[model samples]
Structure formats: C-alpha cells, structure tokens
Target: MPASVVASAGSSPAARVTIVLPTFNERQNIQPILQQLLALRDRFQLELIVVDDDSADGTADFVKQMAHGEPCLRLIRRVGRSGLSSAIKEGLLDSTGDLAVVMDCDGQHEPAAVAAALDLLIARNADLVIGSRFHPDASIKGLSDKREGGSVLANRLARFTLPRYRQLSDFMSGFFALRLDRCLPMIRQVDSQGFKFLYELLSISRGNLMIEEIPLTFQPRTYGSSKLDISVLWDFGVSIIHTLLLRMVPRRAVSFALVGLSGIGVQLLISNLLILLGFSFVASLPPAVIASACSNYLVNNTLTFRHLRLKGLQLLAGLVKFLVVASLPMLANIGLASVFYARVANDTLFAQIAGIAVVFVWNYAASSRFVWNTP
Candidate 1:
C-alpha cells in the first residue's frame, strides 16, 4: 500500500472519517485509489465508500472485489439514477463519520491532499475546506489552455452568483471536506441535480460559514477521458442562475427565465440560419419565434416546472398554451427592440439586449402565473 497519513486532529481515535468517491466507468483508477485511502485507516478511524452510478466498465465489480478483502471499504452501486452530486449525497447520507471528504476518481485529485484538507478542517475549525487548484502554491498540469481558460471563466462566473464563495479561488474543485452534520442541512436545502455541489452548498450557507482553502497541484489524468463537456457547462450555467435568483425570486420563475434565455439563443440562431439560406430577414422572424417558443415550452415543462411536468398528449396542449403566453411578449420584444434601435444613436446591440431583458421579466411573470402555475 502507498504511504497515506491522516492530518493531525484533536478528535478521539474512535471518531470516524468517511471519504465518498463518486465513480462512473472508472475501472482503471478505482483499485489503486482505494488502496491509498484504505491506508489512512492506520492513523484515523476511516471508512471509504464508493458510490457508483452503475458504470458499464465494471467499476462496481472491481469495488465489490476490493470490499471483500478490506472491511473498511464499502460500495453503493446506484442503478437507476446518475450524476455526481446525487452520488455524493447518497454516500453522505449513508456515511458514519464526523467528517466527510468528496473527491474525484479520475486520479487528477491527489490522494495525499485528503490529509491536508482534513488538517485544515481540524486546525482551522472551518465548516468546509476546499482543495483549490488556483491557489498561490497550486500548479495545474496536463490541461489544455482552452480547458484551463474555461475553468478560470467558470470560477469567475460562480463568484458572481455567490459573493460569499468569492473567497474561493477554485469553486469548481470537486475535492473538499465538511462536517457531515452541518453539510446535511445545507444539502437538503439545495437542488443538487447539477454537476457542481460545492456552489450549491456555499449558496445555501449564504456566505456565513467558516470556509478555508488549501493549495494543491492539479495533476494530469493518468487514465480515462475528461467528462467536462458542453452539457456540464450548461448545468453549471443553470446552477449559477439558480443560485443568483434563488435569494429573491421564486424557483419556478427563475427556471422560467433561464429557459427563456436559452430559447432566445435558439431563436437568434435559427433566424440567422434562415437568412443565410436566402430567406428574407423579415420572413424568417415568425418561423424563428415560433420554433423558439415550441422548444422553450418543452424545456420549461421538463426542467423548469419539472415537478408539474406534462407528457405525451399534454405536451401538445402545453405547447399551445406556451405560444399563447409568449405571443404578446414576442411582438413586444420585436417592437420595443426596433424602437430602441431607431432611437439609440449607433448601438443596435444595446436595443436587443434591453428589449430581451424587458420581455424576459414579462414572460416569467405571465408564464409562471398562467401557463404552468401548479403549486
């Protein structure tokens, strides 16, 4: 077994520490990482749990075999549901420990850093301790400039949503430790449907918790491809919108606004595409607006108002209602935007930007109250 040490702590020897590693198709990396974590049992009363989302690559089987030999290692094979946040939540709820640590199974997160995070949690008495890659002493290796740039942009954008977490240089880091009891309450309050849970946790804590950051080098992945994709980025964007508007507006309303934003993007893209295909700009507007509304209704039904979601034939009915709810706003968006463009000196961009803002507020209010207003 590789050398693994527990950070100095004041807790009794009997006090337990659980490390929850969420995995999917991590067959190549699971065994060695488990060996490293299991070694920590010598210093701290430790329990290692692998919460897997039914990886097709034999991740669960590998974990089961390891569990038979090591009494401290446990595996929870999730069958139906998937996602890292939910996997962590399952492990956390089932954890029997004073402190719980969450880390990636991709091997980018150094196994040795776990002890350092625990050290900060013990020494600083922080509610949460993050393993940051952007810290002064941090070094990120093997990531392309584009990927690193995305991380930098995401970290900055997340800060805008929750200023309390602004102190964190790496909010996107999946490695962190917290008191399981303190985290449970906040976890319950957050919608952990998305990729990043730390943002939700800090947003729930509302900038009031005792948080600390520890510098660590982000090592290059030794195996498997990166899971960071456009969908993950979209999830992060939704999380940011949810965090920002959650403080003042109703959840459904915020979701409605977000869905509308995506619809607007779809509309612009389709309209431009039609224009490129030789259709007159004016003739393309109606089809673009209609297409966007239909997509928005489907997205809103499934994601925004998911609790009151419609299906099959009800979708056809919801589409009609969505068009009705969106009709006036569509006309108003165009008229108002055109008026702004005509009045404003040389800024056609400002006109559409301001117009969309106005129409968005109206659509959220009208749609939430009338179209899908299920309590």
Candidate 2:
C-alpha cells in the first residue's frame, strides 16, 4: 500500500477523489495515459493511484521514473500481484478517497469520463455510477463486434442471474466511480477471482446502482496483448454460479463444500474404474484422490482463489497444499473404515459418518488459508 492510494486523495477537501488505474504491460501507452490524466487534472485536481502488476514491458518503471512526487500522481509497483480486479482491490485498500474510480492503464478507459460519473455519484448520492457505452447516444468506438457481444452477453447474464442487480447496461466495464466504503466491503464477499472484479462488485451491489451513459469513444489499447483467455471465460462462468449459489462468505464456503461432494462422486467413479482394470486398492486411491483434487483445483482456481494469483507460484503451491491436506481426510476415512469393518463385519455407514466429520474441518481450514483466501 502506498500513500498515494489515500494520503493525497482528499487533501483538497472540496473535491477529493482517488482515481485507481490497474495496468498490465502497457509500456507504449503509459505516457499518453499520463498526458490525458494531466489534461483532465486541469478540470479536477484529484489524486491518482497507478497499481501496476509487475508488467514485463516496464510500464511501472516508466510511471515511477516520470511521476516522482508530482503531487497527486503515484505508482504502485506490485510484483507477483496480477489481474486487473485484484490490483484495483489493492488500490482501494490503500485509498483514502471519498470516491474511488477504477479504470484501465492501457489508454482505453478515458480519464474525462470520471467527471460525468463523479457528478452523478455526488448529486444523486448513488452508491455506484457506471460509465455505460451501450446508451443510444454514447460514442462507442474501436472495438470488434465479437468483443462487444461478449460483454453484452456476460452483463445480460449477470442481470438475469443476479436478482439484486438489474437495469444496468454496462455491468462488466471497469471504468466507473463509486462510494469507496460501499464497494470495498463487498470485496470480502467478492470472488476477486479470475478477471471479473466488476462482475463480483455487481454481484454484491446492495445499494442503488445509478447508470448514466456519458457519450465517449472507447479507444483500443495501444500496447500489449489482452489478458482475456479461456481461463477468463471459465472464471466468468464460475463467477455467475458463485453469485447465484452463495452471496455471502459463509454461504460461499457451504456451496463449495457441496461442490466438493460432487467431486467425490467423480473421484470414486474413476478410482473404482482403475481398480476394476487391475490397479491395487492403494493405487486406485491415488487416482481417485488425484482426480478429485484436479477437479477441485479447476473450480477453485477459476472461481474461488482467482484473485490471489499474486504469483504463479500460489496456484501450484495451493494444489500441492491441497494434496497434503487431502491426505488427512483420506487417512481418517481409511482408518475408521478398517476398524469398523474388522470389528462389526458391517456398519460401513458408521464409518462414513465418522470419516466425513473429521475431514470437514481439515478441508475447511486448509482451503480457507491456502485456497480461496482474500487477504
């Protein structure tokens, strides 16, 4: 956390804001970004927080070398901390602004739009104000139809699936401003996982959602390849599921446990198949355990622990950690089942009851700390 995220945000008192930009590999666009913001600073002298997730293209360095103590402009060089939404969360935590505006660092999300969004937030006392491009008169430029359609589909799905969030044209756009406190608390409940921070925000948007389309062209990024991929798509799908299934932390954990149960079915099926094909009972167990762990990894990585990809290591470490943790439950099950089978010659049900209870705490504690942890 840097002081720019907060220290200078409300320094002016009259019109204080913290504009947070999440950047990833935008070397060629950083200068144009600063120039545009500097121009907008003439209209409003607000603090700026540039949260860069260790771009290999030297984006953070350019900002740091150029923007040294330039009053209201600061850059946070966050290494190992990746993803746009996660970067924004770091910025918000470090921010002290009454209003927080998050945009892109690729010179795409226009700086001038902040004026319109902030005006709406201040006048209407709105909880969230989105810079919509879907409005009829809005000048939406420089994007492919496919890219545009993807957003439309995702946001439409968001509104449909989420009962509380509705009537918003641009639910996926990162360019917007809102009351800092309202949006920040939702982070605790937010998945922050994968790429859709805005979706997570919209998922838990409890107060009024004020959507006003400020007609402005969306310029294409001038540098670096887009981070959107199959993983992003997978995460988007899981985000909706998580939002619909569980909207709170406790509810989310319970839902994950439910999903874990389904994983057990697949694991057992695979293990039994391997055993039927001439594998040892112990050998079959690894296949089943590994299969279940893999399934859990896919779902949890894409849905639960996505935002914490601060480092690539966290992903691999979490999986290895999962295997280590899963061993406890596996041993517990085997030991209980062996004793019961040997003594009563029956009562498999009794063993299952004891085994499940023991594993519950082991899985919960390990997953909470190593898997879907927020802080």
Q: Put down candidate 2 lDDT per residue, 1-375, tens digits, no spaces.
A: 223323332233344578898887888977877777765565455778889988888888888877775778888888655777778878887886777788877766777777777776666666677777776666667568998888788878877876565666776777888777666677665544534777777666653454444555587767676777876776676666666665544534554565577666766677668868998544565556567767876666664555554247766777777778777776776666556655765654454445445676567667767655642
lDDT of 2: 0.68
lDDT of 2 at 228: 79
Give the CA lDDT, 0 to 100, for residue 273 in model 1: 91
Q: What's the residue-level lDDT of 363 in candidate 1?
A: 72
Q: How many clashes in candidate 2? A: 4
Residue-by-residue lDDT tens digits, candidate 1, 60-165: 9999998888888899998866778778878888998888899999888888998888878877767789999899999899578999998899899988887766
Lowest summed lDDT window (length 10), candidate 1? 1-10
Residue pairs in steric clash, candidate 2?
5-95, 6-96, 80-310, 193-307
Show how many residue pairs clash in every candidate, following the order shown. Answer: 0, 4
Which residue ranges in model 1 land beyond 4 Å of their true spot? Answer: 1-14, 250-256, 264-290, 297-375
TM-score attained by model 2: 0.74
Q: Against the unseen true structure, what C-alpha lDDT does each candidate score?
A: 0.78, 0.68
